[model samples]
Structure formats: C-alpha cells, structure tokens
Target: MEKISSENPSIEKTKFIKSKGLKDKPHNYCPGCGHGIVHRLVAEVVEELGIREKVIAVAPVGCAVFAYDYWNFDVTEAPHGRPPAVATGIKRILPENFVFTYQGDGDLAAIGAAELIHAANRSENITIIFVNNTVYGMTSGQMAPTTLLGQKTLTTPHGREVLRDGYPIKVCELISVLDGARYVARGSVTTPKNVLTTKSYIKKAFLNQIENKGFSIVEILSMCPAGLDMEPLETMEWVDKELIKYFPLGVVKDV
Candidate 1:
C-alpha cells in the first residue's frame, strides 16, 4: 500500500480488486443498468479461463447491441433476433473457438425464439449469455415477450393484461426441458452476492462446452431503470419483490 502522510494514514486500502475484463472506455448503458455488471462477470470468466483471444461473441439488436464497443475482444453483430443462428454457423466453421451469444429478451425470446430453441435442441457446442430485463429496452420502453403479467410499458399503459397481452415467457424453464441442453440456469444481478453467484453460473455454462458436455445458457435478471422510469433503488426493489417472484432465480436444469 502507498502510505501517505498522517493526514490520511487511518484509511485502509483495498487489497484485492476484481478482474476488469472490459476495455478502458465509457459504456453506453444507463446509470442503474445491470448489463454492465453482467458484462464484467462475463469478461472476468473469459479472462480467468484464458479464452479472451478465442472468444467470438454474437450480439444482436437490443440495448446492448453496442456490446462490442465495451468488450476488448472479437465480436460480431447479427440482425435482430438472429444471433443464435449466426453463432451456430461460426461455431461449426471454427469449432475450436469459444462462441457465445449475448441477447436481450426481445432478441432472444421474441423473434429469435425459433433460432434459440432449434440451436439448443441440436446440442450446439456454444454458450448463451441471455439478459432478461423484462421489457424492450432499446425500442423506447415497449412491452416485450418477457414482460411481467402486471408490468406497465409504453404499449400497456395501464398495466399488462393477461388476457390481451399473455403471460411472460419463462425462458430458462422452457429451454431446460430440451434434451440437448446440458446446463440451463437463471440468475439475478440485483445484489453483490447475487452477482458473484451469477458469475459462477456463467463460468459453469462456459466450462460445460470445454468439457464437451453440451449446450448451456445462463439467463440473468437485470435492472433497466431507464426503460422502467424508476430510480435505481426503486428498480432494485422491484426486481427483488416482483420479478423474482415470477422468474425465480436458480439452476433450472443441469446434466
């Protein structure tokens, strides 16, 4: 530690700092957004596994579409809801590479649902990092396929109606049932402890591929205060009190 004069000698210094897997650049995410935290978690895993240079991330349209700008690694952009299909081709051509898809609810659970389901059912040797923020964050706070039953959005101004809007899709639960998926889990980034656990889940998902286990995916519950029109703390509370009740976080399935 750099010891200074007696004026500041009482303050203790931090001994261990977490790995910064991202580049030194300003992120485009909102102040309270949880994507940034998950991004670091993913990066940390890549660095720890010594696969930074071998990673090929497929990013589709969403708030995190500019993810390539933040991660100091190889990343390819796909059309809306086409990351899984694109990732499949890349992984097949370069089987030695660590290929993964980073998708939001709108990109993964909505239009890309077919691609995601088919990919998992085929037991593709790739990792999927899914971020479920509950709404179409990039398209001006619109209602997405994963929006909660009573959640309000630009389309559902007076709370989502189950009859008219239908129920939110449980992505992990749905994908876990597939025979090809060996590892499927849902985690949250609402707190520090949760963040650490989520990172562990991500690591396991990636390792499953290295070990030739099968397809794996980790869906993360993240906050989007910008789209929710709530303060950061308020958003955190909503995630704990409401969202968790619907999409309970845990290891949905593991083989």
Candidate 2:
C-alpha cells in the first residue's frame, strides 16, 4: 500500500486560514449563536475588499459590545443605542476612512430609534449591520422591538399581544422609504444558502459605502438559542418558518 502525498495534484488539498481582518481570539458568543458566523462573514468581506486598514467599526452596547476583541481593526464603544450617532461623528471627521456600526434590534429599533431615523434621513455615508434575534440576548430573554407577535420572551411570557405590544418594527421596509437610504435589505443565517446570501448583502453594503453612496443597512435575522430557550435547531427552524413570514427577505430598496 502506498501512502498519498500531500503535494499530490489529485489530492486536491485545501488550506483554511483565519481571515486577516479577524483577531486570533475566541468569540464570547453563546453556543449556536449567530454572532460568530456573522462576525466571520464581516471579517472575510473586509479582508477581501482590502479595506481592513481604513475600517473603523462602532460597537453597540448589546451582545457584541466587546466586538473590538474579535475584529482586527479600529473599534470604538458607543453608549447604549447610540452607535449611529457615534458612527456619524467618526465618518464626518475621517471622511476617507470606512465606517460602520454593528447593532442589535434593541439598540437600533428601541432606544436608538431616533438616531437610526435621523441618520437615514440625513443620508449619512455609512453601513449599519442590524442583528434581529427577536429577544435581547445580553439582557436576559426580554422581548425586543422586533419581537414577533406571538413570540414568548421574558417580558412577553404569555406571548406577545398586539394590543399591548403593538407590532414588530420592520427595519428594512421602514428605512427603504427614506430617500437617504440608498440601499436596504434583510437577510438570515438559518441555512448555508441563506448565509451566503446574507454575506452578499453585507458585501453590497460595504461596496455602497466605498462608492460614497448614502445610508445603507442590512438587517439580519439571527438565531438566539439561549435567548429563545430552545435548542439550536429549533431556533433555526423558528427563524425560517415563522419570523420570515412577518419580515420577508430580499432587497427592500436600492437606488
């Protein structure tokens, strides 16, 4: 029996290396959390675009508050629900640099609602990666602004009631109507195909910023197994079957 050599052409050897834009550190995200996947996608995109040196990401005060530890670039912490404001200031001062914000639903659609709206209205040349997991992962399993109508969370144990909870805010659709929002789309990470699609949306957002386009946002529907109090597979199923019903996928606006 002859042993196969690693240099053999028929072996089709493949090398897997960590993204250059990502730090060689373990992420603090919970098991089966989508944050890690999204982080890798962002890191890969930045490295591919060759913009890692000019990137400055504004970290939100949610689950990804310590994003600076994982990303190998300049990252600044912002007050609760104030990433958009902080990113705006950074972009204004360093107009030549690439600026973006990583925010969760609670930070973007709840306390930071005004900031999000005004930023889109002003057509700020920046990219926003909004992660919507229905519930706040860092602060227990509380219902978020984008919580589903029948979702059960720490605050909505009896499932959300439309009369009391109103409706889940659709970030992409709401911002698509603003003239300043040149690009708006929603993506998910429930399956491999969806993951690739989400990456494409994120890359498009970054490209828009590189071309000096106005406000661009990619709202990503993520799975939070711990926050939902469900198994990892169950959370993925919920996102694909139920959540997508309320917030459909695809591009909502592109100008």
lDDT of 2: 0.93
Model 2 per-residue lDDT tens digits across residues 144-189: 9999988899999899999999999998999998899999999999
Candidate 1 lands at a TM-score of 0.93
Q: Number of clashing residue pairs in every model?
A: 0, 0
Model 2 Cα displacement at 91 (Å)? 0.5
Candidate 1: 10-residue stretch with minimal lDDT: 5-14
Q: Which digits, one per residue and each the tens of the lDDT, describe model 1 over residues 153-207?
A: 9999999998898989999999988999999999999988799899999999999
Look at candidate 1 and tell me the lDDT of residue 46: 94
Per-prediction TM-score to the true structure, in the order listed: 0.93, 0.94
Supply the global lDDT for candidate 1: 0.91
lDDT score for residue 146 of model 1: 93
Error of 2 at 236 (Å): 0.8
lDDT, candidates in the order shown: 0.91, 0.93
